[model samples]
Target: MTDQAIIKTGGKQYRVAVGDKLRIEKLTADVGANVDFAEVLFVGAGADARIGTPLVEGAKVNAVVRSHGRGKKLIVYKFRRRKNYRRKNGHRQPYTEVEITGISA
Candidate 1:
């Protein structure tokens, strides 16, 4: 067992510890559903740690999906000088809220 772990999801990596809350890319899970992150890149604490070449075998990070929602809106604007062309757009990225429950290696 380790005190912290590095897990990969949604093309990103996050270093997490137990009871940590984080927002991640949208997941296909309902609120309060248990989720397991199997793509663990590293696990350990202090001087004892295990790093995987890509992913650690038999390493998993357990978490619970707390909620799903959209992030803050972002505005995108485009303009062409002397062309009278203008464009504006807004976007909100979907995300899932999760809490780290446990990490097993």
Candidate 2:
């Protein structure tokens, strides 16, 4: 069995394996650029598993930035009953799509 790792990025943690694709907080890399994640919290599984005290030394997850885009828009409405006050807002969070290529620990 291959190793799976939990990597932290953009203030969030994600469990990943090779070839897995996910949308995460927008990164500064250009499309098709290689990115390396060094904050690996956990790696492997079963008897070979290793856990990090904050982070596992010499562990890393490699990926390629696929695309950057914003998510679906969300509408937020606020109103004050009987006060004739209302506000409506729309939001779309930006994110980057990435494909995990390799992991080393």
Candidate 3:
């Protein structure tokens, strides 16, 4: 059996294990920097699982910043049929990639 855990960050929850890479919301850290997430939602080892109320005290998940990049561009278009008005725009959301290093509970 493998050990797995769920952590919350940036208004999102991610189920991850060691050495797993994930792309999430923009974080204020440089590449190769270590970040700790204290809000653990759940953890599983073998057949036993533990859950937290909002967060578990003394529980943390550490990760290393891998890279920062912008996501795919999304086109926004607004048009009115009778008014003959049209607007077009594009947007790209910034994001950060991180690799899970260890989880302690």
Which candidate leads in lDDT?
Answer: 2
Predicted candidate 3 versus true structure: per-residue lDDT over 1-105, tens digit per residue: 566889988898999999999999999999999999888988778667788887767788999999999999999999999998999999999999999999888
RMSD of each: 1.5, 0.8, 1.3
State the displacement of the C-alpha of residue 74, model 1, in Å, after optimal TM-score superposition. 0.7
Q: For model 2, how does the per-residue alpha-carbon lDDT over 1-105 read when each residue is reduced to its tens digit?
A: 778999999999999999999999999999999999999999997899999999999999999999999999999999999999999999999999999999999
Per-residue lDDT tens digits for candidate 1, residues 1-105, read 449999999999999999999999999999999999999999988787889998888999999999999999999999999999999999999999999999999
Give the C-alpha miss distance for residue 58 in model 3, angstroms.
Answer: 1.7
Worst 10 residues of 3 by lDDT: 43-52
lDDT of 2 at 62: 98
Which candidate number would show the highest TM-score if scored against the true structure? Answer: 2
Worst 10 residues of 2 by lDDT: 1-10
lDDT to native, each model: 0.95, 0.97, 0.90
